[model samples]
Target: MTGDVDVRRIRNSSFLTWVGLVLGSWVGLLWGSLLFMPVGAGFGIAAASAMGGYIAVPLWGTFWGLTGLSGQRNKALRDLGIKVLPDDDPLTQRVGALAARLGLTTRPWVAIMPHNNAFAIGATRNSAMVVLGQPLINTLTDAELDAIIGHELGHIATNDMRRMGLARSFQNALVWYFGFSRTLQRWVRWILTWMSEFLILAMSRRREYWADAVGAALTSKEDMISALEKLHHKPRLSSYERHHARLMIHGVDSSVFSTHPNFLQRKRALEKEKYLRFVKKPVVAEEVLAAPVTLPLVAEMAYVNSK
Candidate 1:
């Protein structure tokens, strides 16, 4: 047998984490949170802090997570110093028009990155920003570009960032603040963090597929398909951005922690969805055909609103 070991599968497995969660959640929460009781009694802290340990930290963490303007800070992008696309730029106009169509309360600031990838970031739709790659601009047609932007906007429209952030903060509070029962912080934290997988249960992979459906509906199925076909490679990203892979358009294919479906899987799923171009208007005294759309009506509404 070759001495080279393949740990690729093991790295992303959440099986052990799940086991620990099932067995340790109650013990960790009940014991850890109440430890503040004895700690307060011994240290003689203020009555509010003594009594507040259980609720305060969690609320604080969640508030910061949900309301934090993540896109405003470029540290996550490794200080790449993003320059916002010009308002008069064709691509910028397309992005703005698409944002309006999606009914996003916040007008996303579109920036061009040197990498061949794109992503959306913000705690909520109100703070969303869309970062596009320079290379991707030259690679796709106008329609394809709109479809790609539409996919990113779908993420903003659903407020995926805030949801994921809230989950992360909630779990962090439970792990760091409350997971200290009888000073056994190490064991408690391990269990809690393992259970949450760092970003709380990890954003559902379904969101990626849903975004694809929305993109297809907003533009045309052909454009969406073409865009996905062109972007088959694993995206190149800076270290910090790679750390935030869950927010990007592309990622590892078959890992449990991956935020996107495999390209083939996405394409196949899109084959069964309803795009605006595919939806036919009703006609009297004519043969009527039903469109087999597996996606929700929200996609249709989004498409219609854009028109």
Candidate 2:
């Protein structure tokens, strides 16, 4: 019975395993080359007055592309009124210790946002930021939050955060390429532009599933599934909560174009594997473990995987 179940679970893992990594990398490379290459080449040609400057355009573009991610992250933080936590707080220590346990080379800035939320984004492994909502601390148990943190760490490990930055860069380059005008040229251009945002977001959603899988493997499948249920069962659009309009763990929108999968799908995906095994010998906080372990954060109390 154990062998049969393990084989079935392994098969499911295979199906979803590499798909997100391949898709994120491919889209990143494709969109980066298509959108930025021309701009880099143009700048290089225009700056041909200086031999070194001409040679530096492509390199410059790559540098700026990554640096530009900071601005986008800042805007998101600003809009949400997220406050950066002082580095010496107990919460920060706990979260950082978990991050270290997870083997994340970069330590993300920890912030408190107003909503029941947490998100990770940065240009490189070193630039990742993990933000948690105050409400999450009040709502979720320690382990639930850990599962959530593990999910975000998974994103950092996979460089999905960097990929998101690259996607945004592609969008910006697309806007520049089209002169930021809706002068509906041909059907082809319209189709391409119309699908650009969708493609970027779709790619993000795919990465979410990968993160979920990783989180389940790190913790127990039961932990991930239970966390989802907790999020989905929250009061309907509670205003006192941190995020209002955003359909996070439990909220809903009239439309189907959600940034994430519905709670049921996520729960099923994580719980359809071994549960008792991991829980029996769960990996906990430590500098090192003999076996691979995942570290999670408090925001995961309700939220996991941002796409």
lDDT of 2 by residue, 1-307 (tens): 2110111221223123234433433343344334434445664443332233222333443455567765656866677677888889877776676666555545677787766655676656677777776777888877777777766666666666556655555454444433423442233235545576677656556566666665565566777677667767765555634242221333332334445667776776666633323212233456254554445554564365652
**What lDDT score is found at residue 26 in candidate 1?**
40
What's the distance in Å from true for residue 98, model 1?
Answer: 1.3
TM-score of each: 0.67, 0.61
Where is the poorest 10-residue window by lDDT in model 2?
1-10
lDDT of 1 by residue, 1-307 (tens): 1111111221222334333333334444554444545543533343333354445555655466645646433554456667677778877787878777655545777888877777888655666678887877888888988889988887776656665565555566666665444454666566667766733434456667767766776677778888988887644456755666677776555666666677887887788663232221224343333544457776987899999
Instruction: Give Cα-based local distance difference scores for all models.
Output: 0.62, 0.55
**Where in model 1 is the C-alpha error above 4 Å?**
1-28, 31-53, 70-78, 182-184, 198-204, 234-240, 274-307
Model 2, residue 167: C-alpha shift (Å): 1.5
Pull out the clashing pairs in model 1. Answer: none
For residue 46, model 1's alpha carbon misses the true position, in angstroms, by: 23
